[model samples]
Target: MSSISRPSAAASAHAETIRFEAADGHPLEGTLTTGPGHGPLALISAATAVKRGFYQKFAESLVTEHGFRAALTYDYRGTGGSVSQDFNPRHISMADWGMKDFPAALARLELVAPGHRVVGVGQSYGGQALGLGNVSERFERYLMVATISGYWRNLGGGFKLYALMNLVANPVAFLVGHVPSGMGLGSGLPGGVFSDWTRWCNRPDYFFSEEPRFDAKNLFASVRTPILAIGATDDPWGTPAAREAIMRHFTNAPVETRWLDPQEAGGPIGHLDFFRSRFRETLWPEAIGWLKGEAQA
Candidate 1:
């Protein structure tokens, strides 16, 4: 129901603006990249505070070196370039991204580029959204990096506070049309996204709880696509328990889980740096190797 601006000149050559209708009739914005070679298509979902540009470097790398035909990335409603006129910064919910934004993007891709084997790469909250969306047989494979399956008991200091504020302050902020100054976990998020994230943090089970259940485990169980779950040993957000929780959900999917430490990888790659840093020259090789192996099999 809201208009999304086209990609800027800096990104236009490698990206194109795409519009698609969701099952609920909401309009979704996306970026499509068609590289020179023929291969499977990849869709990238952004983390909580980052936008699609955060994925530009890695998507381009996948396109040029890996021979992928295209990569599609998009912003969920109320974030970055996809803000809606009806968007009340205090009233947004993470469920909107999982149920509406992500599915709409996938449906659009299916319509626009029919018959291509699609792959999804998700990071952090994006990984959660992908997990919530589930990997259907429509996709060739699924890759989850720095993903959190649920919030459970052992989140962290910042996250615990975030959850608390959402329970106590969010409604008050909504009535007053402002978010508390320190409520945001990370920078660059609009008030709506911040509030939505706060709500997730407040809940012990994250997206898997009965109250606002998104059926993440059901999605994983039904996935016919191969999966690769990547986590960093030093990432507090993607702790061992969190990573194991995600793996457990995908019981039926063929999956490989890797725990990477900067020391073991012979680099300083941490959680977010795996996509943003020069370590891609080392890291992507392993990823591509796995992808190729899966393709051959």
Candidate 2:
């Protein structure tokens, strides 16, 4: 509940580095962007292994540009600022990011902004985590960017099949208990996290394969919030079909998918570009407009 920072008057926004704990009492850290007071909340969840800094501009913009009361962004346990240098990757799993870490962020938002509407933007793996627990129902609306079922088959290339088969399904990842850096996942990921990710990616049903253990079907089906799912034509990992495959599980929610072409963006808007500051003028407004409309409706 402690926030540590002063407002930078120039931007009409302030960022506070706050410390919070998950339901499991797992300590976590994140940044809260807005004024000292609260109004409408914007929870910006990050992609797999993606840190809070990646969304700093977007979070702050929610307050200064989009008229949000506040925005929250954080790191999952065992990744980014939340984990210690000696952290053991084996202690965490991809499921924990949704069921545990995401809920914790929700609770933190609740503490900071009581009796107000909250909107969320879940990017990539973040969008998947939204359906993992009871948190999605709390948001007035949500926008998912580049979120997909990550099924290897949905993607093109025999190289993907070969690479995933030999690299991830083998003993190296299991023995090391982590996907080492330079694997293209940025900063790398805990072995437990990557293993669960591998399992989900291998299945067309993605996380549903972990059924019975987590009640993936009913858990996702329970969400009633309206969702806007965005897919980019250039994103190999989150193709339109791949994104739709996973979002289909939100049977109770009214979902909409909008595909963006790189040509319209004046450049490439890959799986990771939507949040980049350069798109603040082009793509971000589209997201903000949709969220405002949904949350108010």
Candidate 3:
């Protein structure tokens, strides 16, 4: 493996733009947040449709607070920095994000910090996708935030029915050949990614229940890394039931599940808010401490 060059110190502390390639040879874009040498390496994976920059502050904190050797945040194919001006969206799928994009990031991390044990800190779909990827064995541990099954029925109130109708986004994607930034829809998702996502959320078992299902069940079951799965009490996408539904797939991983209550910390910690900069004083430190094994679960 070719060594990944570190940027100048000024550029390394914040966002150091980097490029890598997937197994399929698709170019991917990311940023590295560097720390002092000889610390653990980390990869901060973003949620679906969320760009790498969304986790900029969080990635930086891994160095400032947790003393990571370096932290990475990358965009999936056809999104954000990874998408070239001439990129084609017609052929992408959710499986590509898991089985391909994530593994690419893991490979990049290995080259960036050759001997360090890697920690995967993923948010929402980011954490879910990790299990489907083939690189889980490379991770020393996982920090799963707001990551849960979107099976819909596990959610409370009318949200389940609303999620069942998420399939409506698929028709729009088919018509436009890409998902438009419509109400309740993520922008720039490939037609197949959007369709596959809706298909998972609408099913009784999400991705695991699909016919001719992707190999996620087997992949996840094989993971032996320790996992800390955090679900927000107020998060519609990752309720207690939703978290339980998806985490069961990791049959061999020893997972410690925790519910983060925004009420206890004085904020509305929804599905996406847990990683926001505002919580740097609250959930952020708590999570970092957890990953460092500073405290018991």
Candidate 4:
């Protein structure tokens, strides 16, 4: 546990820890950032293996710096403060994260701050979950950052190694009962999570056809909510084709696509860099401004 390790919020001036349950009645934890006289709510959905603390700074920014009335950052079951049971004993997959936890977070946010427009900020796997389990309608606006169909064939250059890593990694996960941290992935993952991730990455349709458990109706076509889908040039996995392959499913949403260049963005904007605090000046303005309807063309 680093400085960001799960804190009980201590009832900070602008943030508070809130405990909620996933759709499965699984216990979960989150932090809510809010202030007086705010507008919409921002929900920060984290990427696979990444914890809610990873998004805490961004969540605070939504309320502190941006116009959002409140922001909620939470961990899916078996991750962060929500991990009540050991990983080896139970099966947990993206479907659990998407179909169950994401909606529960949204419902909790609604309870905490009712009647406000809900905005979603989904990073990588976070973006995929919105369409996976029919939570798109809950968000009046959505932003997808580095969210892509992780099919290795769609990736280019060094990113093609994602598949190789999966080959090497999955076996190790099976042996160890978990996906050890590092090896390019940010955090240690439950064996089931890494299993689902690799299995989906193997398919052209990604999660759409990779798993029978993901049989929920494809809701991407049904989402009328406005979307901002951003691709980073330096991100190997989030290639233009990869991003397009997944986002093209949102037929009904007014999708605005943008590619961020490291030169213009002031630094290398990798897949994980978008949420990092360093880019708060150069990159966040356009992304956050768009939601506030204050973005420049």
Best by lDDT: 2
Q: Model 1, stretches more than 4 Å misplaced?
A: 1-13, 89-91, 150-152, 156-184, 187-196, 211-214, 292-297
Clashes per model (N, Cα, C within 3 A): 1, 2, 0, 0
Per-residue C-alpha lDDT of model 3 across residues 1-297, encoded as one tens digit per residue: 223554533443655788888898877888877867456788888888788887888887778766778888899988887875455676778888888899999888788668777889988888887788877888888999988887777765356455434646667777887776654654567777877877787777888855465667787898888999988888866777888888999899999988888888679988788878888887887778777767655
Tens digit of per-residue lDDT, candidate 4, span 192-217: 77788788777788777743555533
RMSD of 3: 3.0
Per-prediction TM-score, please?
Answer: 0.81, 0.91, 0.90, 0.89
Per residue, candidate 2 scores C-alpha lDDT tens digits across 10-84 of: 368878888888887677899888764344798888998688889998887778877888889999887777775
Candidate 2 overall Cα lDDT vs. reference? 0.80
Query: Which candidate model has the greater TM-score, 2 or 3?
Result: 2
The lDDT of model 1 is 0.67
Per residue, candidate 1 scores C-alpha lDDT tens digits across 1-297 of 333444433332356667665566555677776666667788788777667777877777777777777787888776666666666655655667766788777876665468877878888777666556653666777787887754545444455655556665566555665454445443344456556565556565655554434565576577667778888877766677767755677677787788888887767655577787476677776776565444422
Among all windows of 10 consecutive residues in model 1, the one with the lowest summed lDDT is: 4-13
TM-score of 4: 0.89
Q: In terms of lDDT, which candidate is stronger, 1 or 3?
A: 3
- Location of the lowest summed lDDT over 10 successive residues in candidate 4: 1-10
Candidates in descending TM-score order: 2, 3, 4, 1
Q: What's model 3's lDDT at 36?
A: 73
Order the numbered candidates by lDDT, best leading.
2, 3, 4, 1
Candidate lDDT values, in order: 0.67, 0.80, 0.79, 0.77
